[model samples]
Target: MANVAAILGDVVEGDRIFSPTSLHLPEFLPAEAVVYPTTEAELAAVMACAHQHRWRVVPTGSGSKLAWGGIGAGVDLIVSTARLNQVIDHAVGDMTLTAQAGAKLADLAPLLAQHNQFLAVDPAYPDRATLGGIVATADTGSLRQRYGGLRDMLIGISFVRYDGQVAKAGGRVVKNVAGYDLMKLLTGSYGTLGVIAQLTFRLYPRQEASKTVVATGTADAVAALAGELRRSPLTPVSFDLLSPALANALGYGEQFAVLARFQSIAAGVDEQVQALSALVGASLTHQILGDDEDENIWAAAGKALFPQPEAAGQTVLAKVGLPSDRAIAWLAQLPSGSLARIHASSGLGTVRWAATTAEDVEKLRFTVADLSRAGVEGTSGYLTLLEAPLSLKQSVDVWGYGGNALSVMKALKAQFDPGNSLSPGRFVGGL
Candidate 1:
């Protein structure tokens, strides 16, 4: 195996080579490697070299979400898919599209909608995020409320293992569940599990009509409404709770936005709308928002996660999951003095929080770590975004805690790429 400089050639510009980490200014990157491959053949060549030498490999999509997982323990050669972007297939009638990992969502969304259908699982940063990155990171935003997250929408995936073997799982048939759901197994596993090269997902008809009903209030009140809205027959794509202040940022003065998304034949909307009204509190009244309105309010509230005062200056952002009811109250336990922003699924279960600085992240680490040791804290599971300072990497326990499934995760990683060459310490349990 050649030295990193020799093997990567021009792709390895000494010292000048940069990573997606700086975009968010993350704290740590354990390995020191970068490799850009223009084709699958080049990817294979690079993988062959890394595998032979037992070098940790980090495969990248758009790098739009490098902050999603723990910092790469150390990158031996950043096998970037930036150059491998291509739409291999767009089977409209089949409602299936296939593309290289580096293909951007901005590129895919409009294309999918051309056939009156769309890839429903999209985050706010659709323009910069790639299909593979989003899946590897398992990211989805407000729209996820309606269509479900990537794990549910993903139908098939093809990737390169650490040992350079190309493998695939799942199939294009939207309804088929022929075997173990390897595609889902990889979802939310971070990049440690596999390097997603191409993916196929079931799409939904582009929403014909949608609306957001802003319901403003306190956290407890919002929690109650969140439950009510979720249980109602309104069929909301999602109902997100915004802080009174967050609501104001979106011009909703102290009111939490209960964005109830709807999709159906035109006539039923009136019935759903009426049903929602009956379910909400008497104190709450909605300001009906249309496409532009729905777009502006939630866009600011949903994707505005990064700017959250708590998470803004920090180098990490984490998405956490717990029983739906207790999410709001958990915010009280965030690192002291940390500026953070949070979004809870209508059920109060899944939440995403972005912490501002590396120091604040340390606060988060200990907080979650303590809870883990004690066992049965409010935060059941979490995904780290060590996208901050390198120093914080050592001080803080980045991946807060784990469940009984971690042993299984490590075993699977070993089984898939026994070399331990793919995203070594970047995933949960340092797989």
Candidate 2:
């Protein structure tokens, strides 16, 4: 501890460094000290010191997702980008924005709104989730149905490597793509590759109007509507399949439901809403929400599935990926108390619940295994445990991936951090 403080003392202020005991961190990560670096250079210096001493480091931003992924063996130092929050540039004309890793999404929203532009990804906890953390976790919400994931919006990235060397990839402009696609590589590396320092993301013009059409009915009826909407020409920003519990929580009755949100010119949005309502017909009860009602519904749905600051250790959260056609069936198979919100087109979303016993974990694991066997041909279905009690995490593999990419991922991890000095054993296959 003394050695770490002495080495990094000159890089950052003494008040910016503290003992790990002062913060609420996961028990699996036994970090000696936590340091907040205000600039990319200061962060690079800290990484260099840790590399020289072969000290394992865990990179974080606000520590919101520190408990995600696998439990690490241990960490000697924790480096945070909390103080590195800053908007580097906002090229309004170019439709791109560059910012520091610690800049919260919530803070960027209003700024972009002022220019009638916004980042297209809808990640969890915008109030506290930073650009780096959102990219690291790949937590893009249902907006992915239209705008794609964070990797798609991200045009460039800068990070401090394990050896304390700063590295960059891509360019600020959306058209620049001359180098290795490290932007995508580092997007979901879980900080096992490097510490994200800054990012540049492509932005979209804010729509003039927005509306959501929510339809509630039996699983078959909702699935029919979802299929019809996908085949239609209507473009929705969000198309999510709500599980029974999630639907009930959203005041939509305890049944399967699908929520489709459209954003465009006022006339366009109104036409699409009416078209969707016509498709709903008499098969299912439906409602069209506009203005504040539309925004509130989406916010409530996001909060229900995403991990919150208050539900840290007491709840279990998992990311589910399956065949889009089988999403309704998959939701139907989930445990009774579980709440889920999955993207209807991409078949990716979150499932969460308050788990109390070992039996509950086993049952969920069995359910996942059964579903995996029934997935589409040549595609692997997976359920990654994102957040849960330490005991449950220890008992089950957090990443239940049984694909053939383990060897390749291991090689990449070895090449990135040879000494295993960055967030060790916290990624897939213990990469």
Candidate 3:
């Protein structure tokens, strides 16, 4: 550690480098040091040093979603993008913004709001979540139903390879080169491909008005309404099916409810709200939410999506993916007390429940396995435990299945990080 610090002179701080004990990093992966870089050049220098030493490096941003992905096998250095945070450009006319990778969405959001534009992706922990972390994790929230996720919003990226080569793909403009497609390759790679330095994303104009319509019914009925909304002309920015537990948590009287968010001109929003209410009709009671009420409900739902317990072992969270049409059926398969918030249109869902006993861990393992088997047998689904007790993590494969893409993923990893210096084993198929 001292040798690398000395090599970088005063640029690297010895105090910041330490073992990975603070963040929710894999307990099994022992990190020798954590280096903080304020600039891309410094990041490249550190990575080059690590590569020369053959030390495995794990690039991180805020450590918010560090525990995601497979278990890291030999992580020696933690390269953090803490101080490299800045809004490099905001071409409002072009509806695009470029920011340093470490810039938190929380900070960037307010700036964009000033210009009547905003990034569409909405992940949890916005206050602490950095742009690089969000992109690396490919995290998205309910807003994805309307604007799509990070993959769609991102237009350009700059990254430092394991060998310290700085590379970029795409550009500030919407149109770009055709080959490589590095933007898509690195977006959700969990930082295994390269250390993301800067990102350029297309922005959306803030809607003139917004409203959320809430409706309650049985799972089948809620699914039917969700299906109807998809087929109808009503354009909701977010269409979510809330679990009974989650619905109750959000202060809804019913156990199951559908929350639809509309954003457009005031008149259009009003029309969509009325049409949505009529679609539910007598089958379910509906309510058009005031701005305050709408914010409160969506805020609660976001918290539920990434629940943080007051104490350890209080909750276990997992992400599930299924066919949009089979979401209800899949929800029915979960054990009672399990709570979920699902994107009705995307078929992506997140499940959470209290972790009270060893039995619960076993049940979770079984559930993940069952979902994996279903995907294999043509049901087309997947389940991944995102947060859990260390004991529970050790007991099962958090990533249920890798599928046939495992080989190709492995080949890509070998080509990009043959030295295994970039987030080793912290990827699909343990790449």
Clashes of each: 31, 0, 1
lDDT of 2 by residue, 69-124 (tens): 99987898999898889999999999999999999999899999999999887777
In model 3, residue pairs whose N, Cα or C atoms come closer than 3 Å (at least 3 residues apart or on different chains), thus clashing, are 244-255
Off by over 4 Å in 2: 1-3, 21-23, 356-359, 365-369, 372-375
Top-down TM-score ranking: 2, 3, 1
Ranking by lDDT: 2, 3, 1
Worst 10 residues of 3 by lDDT: 305-314
Each candidate structure's TM-score, on Cα atoms with residue i matched to residue i, is 0.84, 0.96, 0.92
Superposed model 3: Cα runs more than 4 Å off? 1-26, 309-312, 355-377
The residue-level lDDT of candidate 2 at 397 comes to 78
Candidate number with greatest lDDT: 2
| lDDT (Cα, tens digit) per residue for candidate 1, span 1-431 | 24565655543344423443433323354345555566666666667767877777777675656655566566665666766679888878888887888888888777777788877764636667788778877777666676777888898888877767777888877887777788898887777866777888887776667666666666666668777765665577765655444555666675544566666665666567667766677666676676797677666765555443334553344555444454445444653323233444522222234454556655554554444334445444453543444555555556665567788887898888787778777776667
